[model samples]
Target: MQPTKTNIFLYLVAILVNLLSFSIGVSITWITSVIPKVDGSTITDDNPFGRLLTASEISWIAGFLPLGAAIGPLAVGKISDKIGRKKSLLILGCVNILSLVITVFAKQTVLFYISRFLAGVVLGSSYSVIPVFMAEISENHNRGALGCSVGIFVAIGMNFALVAGPYLSISVYSLLCISPLLIFVPGFFILSPETPWYLAARNDEKRLTKSLLKLRNKTVEEIHLEMTSILEVVVENETAAKAGVRDLCTNNTLRKSLLICLVIICLQQCGGIAAVLIYMPKIFEAAKTNLAPEICAIIVGVFQVFGTIVSSVVVDRLGRRILLLVSSVFTCLTLVTLGLYFRLNLSDVVWLSWLPLFSLVVYIFTFNVGLGPVPWVVMSELFPSNFTSIAAALTSSTCFMNTFIVTVTFPYLSTFLGMANCFFLFTVVTICGAIFIYMVLPETKGKSLQEIQKLLGSCG
Candidate 1:
């Protein structure tokens, strides 16, 4: 709590690690702004591509990112465990840089698809590695806030893409987004320390001691106590043999943790966040609001960033379960309202046209407050250090898979069922998700990693 050297160091590292989220945000949301321009617009003589993309090509460009992301985490997760979190993150940065380069030079639809797919790989890698890195480096009290920083930066990235994409050409936007990756790659290398938890798990006592010293402002006794706690969990994990997919499935605690993680991520995706983000411009276009669709998207992105900042501030104080429960309930309500607004718009309800915009803003805000970040934070807290990589990979993969499904099918589903009916279905899912969380999730405020592990283990 005091402004010691260690505290300053940890906060600096937290800031650096969270920058990865910005690249992720840009990658995922870039298409949202880019698609409208490239889909139907006339190509100027000066334009390098010289052709507009077809609808089917746009769909592939949109859908393949998550598909590639689904594959990225599986490999990156294992690589993170084998190498280290820092190195894995650097690799992600490299991937992002390469993807941007491809995007800049890409003249063909296939090249665009490949660039987007590569971007997805960075996203998948970041989601898998960054949580583990934050959890291992942060003190118990700071863990939740640091974990939620990922969401904060992600929101910032989304907003940046939304606000800038309309103004800048695709090439300019791609180049601008690469700045963060460039800064993050070297900045992290110089500033960040390997996590003490990771060092202990790898049986490197000297580095573990050094890492603990850099991360903690406590006395030698307190540092020893913390080291012992981490070691006990590491030893217990080792006793079960090497941690893997089988260990995650066969061990009772790890299994429960994996299930909870997967369920949370599924609910997070199915709750319609991806659908809302992907279709924001279309939604605004359909609503025929006074503001331009791009402007409305910027507003929504601003709200999202604000909500994530609020979540970072209160996640430790309010606790995870309460925020998630509250978030789910309110999000369901907003979705229902949005559904009704869309349904009414189909009628002669001209005066209530503003409801869609209002409801979506509220919905995005509520989601970022809890459901957006808490699930990832809880996922990091749930698994032991030994199993964190594989579990994170599996969970991150599941999240992206669901995202892919929702992203790919949303246009068709909304077309067939109508936007109102689509949202109505999501409302039902939100309700179910709320009930599950209230009945099952444990409060993880102020608890150490080992304590949380024991608490979860005892649940079985």
Candidate 2:
């Protein structure tokens, strides 16, 4: 067998990184479904909070983790820049354990909110740190797959949480979802190693050597040569300051990257992804169905896994821009159709008993194809290393805000605008998303991060 750049140890570490992301996915996804158990259901509109409150409160609960997770990529990116990705991951592991301890015992909405908020912080961190870890460890040919593995694992974590969460009763059973932490905590600790890029960033040769030995134990010469190439790339791309908001804004290239980040993320949430993912049951009711919404939830979650798997497989081969464009076109059609279907109240036709379910399934498939995996892939590819994490944070923050607005607004929107209008509104927004992506979004596949930055840089 040909020797591989990724050693068993680094592969294991990458797996740990994926596991952390997955656990976060499960923790975040599962608990979100449980929030209404305390907060109340939107369909009935009779929570401890008012119906509007049920919307507002659930929005707060649902948005917190992503909001909190938004902070992570920036924090871990910086920490990884300074300490190392492995150490950063380990610290997050500790934070995960601590946050869960608090969440598991949380009594009130406030405490629960804090737990979700803090957990989001950790989630964001994992997103930032793990890719850097993977990119640093793998050879160029393998990096894309390795980077994408994070998505697969993320789906795995989310799906596991989805299947398990609804099956178990809420409250304590909900709390038990934290168990991924136990598996991840020890698994990341003993099994995961520090990212070599991190070691090189800090100029920790000894530790870098150790990381090299762990990932590629074949020869010190091979390790040294590999480290040199990576460092040269890093040095060649080195900039004057860290990836501050100012630098991101003032520089035309960085600004475009930021815009891409913002637009794509906005596109992602505006697709009404949260409605289906967060409230599968509510969406089914919109479809006027007798089917189990929970089953649909699991189904949607599974689509994410499979869609991401497909994207990971074909992203390099088919190219990023085409996939995005195709994804957007399909989504536009689905959203409009879904909107009109509800608008026409076509759910009750004898032959179309499963219309809502079908719409949802198709929507899920299209979403997973277009918005689910593409945004993150784009974000990671857009920024240079220095700006990568904080850029991720900024991107994540904007995305989550859009997400927050949509989630908080959906219930009220459906009531005020009417359900048909709501879906139609989503359709309109998605159509616009397709246009913006075509016009403004840059193609990044098959280019190094630095090359992308150069291509995006202003000529004048």
Candidate 3:
């Protein structure tokens, strides 16, 4: 990799671009705090409607975001392809700002529903486009590290929402959530350059040279060689047949890449992180822990951010497959242990009141380091350039769809099966994920985009 000092501009761009992720993280967990306040319970002092929202209505409120997100990637993928990543993101930021403004003024559930669904559209679009943008701008050696930074910003946003949501009124919290996009929209537009790949694909040599000058620290000779390589890939894509869902399924290399992406994304969501995060405060309340539910959620969120920091530092060093395997195994163990703790609670094991907090801290930390972030990095690396945008959309939409199912069903599942049983079920799913990772995933660490495609192409 280039020396750390030379990559400062690149890192800055990564940080600015990922502020979109920060907003997404806040949207995911904001409902947890808001639900109690609006449920017409003792907490009705903060209720906007001064009336009870039925459990079904509340579930829809929480579900709408992911539901909208599940639909966003399909449309946004095409938008990014047609308009380019930078412009697509700018549009998303404007839309996000508008949605949050609506949210601040919303007194009716319908308005909240509309605002959240719009936010989800932004969420899905960001996930679809951000990885491609990051991958295109990054150097081969640092791509994993930079791509994994998505989880860091997301964790920070989730932590911010958890810590701030309880203290602020709904309007105040909603307005505060708008701050990231306000910063991101202007900052990214002014400071960040378009990816060299996008410019090269359009044969815009003048702009492509300028973008590379901003993004690369290499000498002119090296930049020329890199530009040649990019142009070659663009030519190859230009000559290749158009790819679609049907084409993706029939092509061997693309099919394997897509299957890998789908499996990891499904595993990522099915491991129950989304449900855990969305219901964290409720989980603590249900566990009857000594610490306040909000406090426990905040603590776990802090650990989550820490874990992503660790992942960013070590990802390129430790490699992707190993971290994923270790994360999956340990995450499985934590969930199984957590399930056991809840099950044994029937016997009055108040002595282990701290177990849930300890278990969750480790769970969140482990999840972030590997399963949380590495899958996104791997997804970005696995696909060919021609297929990147559409493949990313398919993967992201599937991811959010799984998230929607898990988040919407968690309450009902916990009520019917008990939290212990629910966790046990998650443990089983995680174990299967671990096996899949070991048996199927190829190591992509330190590989170039071309090299990764070759590796996937060679896979039987």
In candidate 3, which residue pairs get closer than 3 Å at backbone N, Cα or C atoms, i.e. clash?
Answer: none
Clashing pairs in 1: none
Mind giving the per-residue lDDT tens digits that candidate 2 earns over 116-152? 7878887767765666567667655556667777778
Candidate 2: regions farther than 4 A off: 1-7, 35-56, 70-77, 239-242, 458-460
TM match of model 3 to true structure? 0.97
Please provide TM-scores, in order, for all candidate models, with all chains considered together.
Answer: 0.96, 0.88, 0.97
lDDT digits (tens) for residues 1-460 of candidate 3: 5455449889889989989889888888888778767764554657887788887888888888898889999999988888899999999889989988997888899998898899888888888899899999998888988898998998898899999998888999999999999999999999988899888878999999888887876666768999999999877866875758887899888888899899989999999998898888788877788998889989999999999999989999999999999999889989998899878883256887888898999999999989998998998998777788999999999999998898889889999999999999999899988888999999998998988878887885
lDDT of each: 0.87, 0.70, 0.88
Each candidate: RMSD:
1.6, 3.5, 1.5
| lDDT by residue (tens digit), candidate 1, 284-304 | 888778788899999999999
Candidate 2 lowest-lDDT run of ten = 43-52
Lowest lDDT 10-residue stretch of candidate 1: 39-48
**Candidate 2, 215: how far from true, in Å?**
2.7
Residue 424 lDDT, candidate 1, scale 0-100? 94
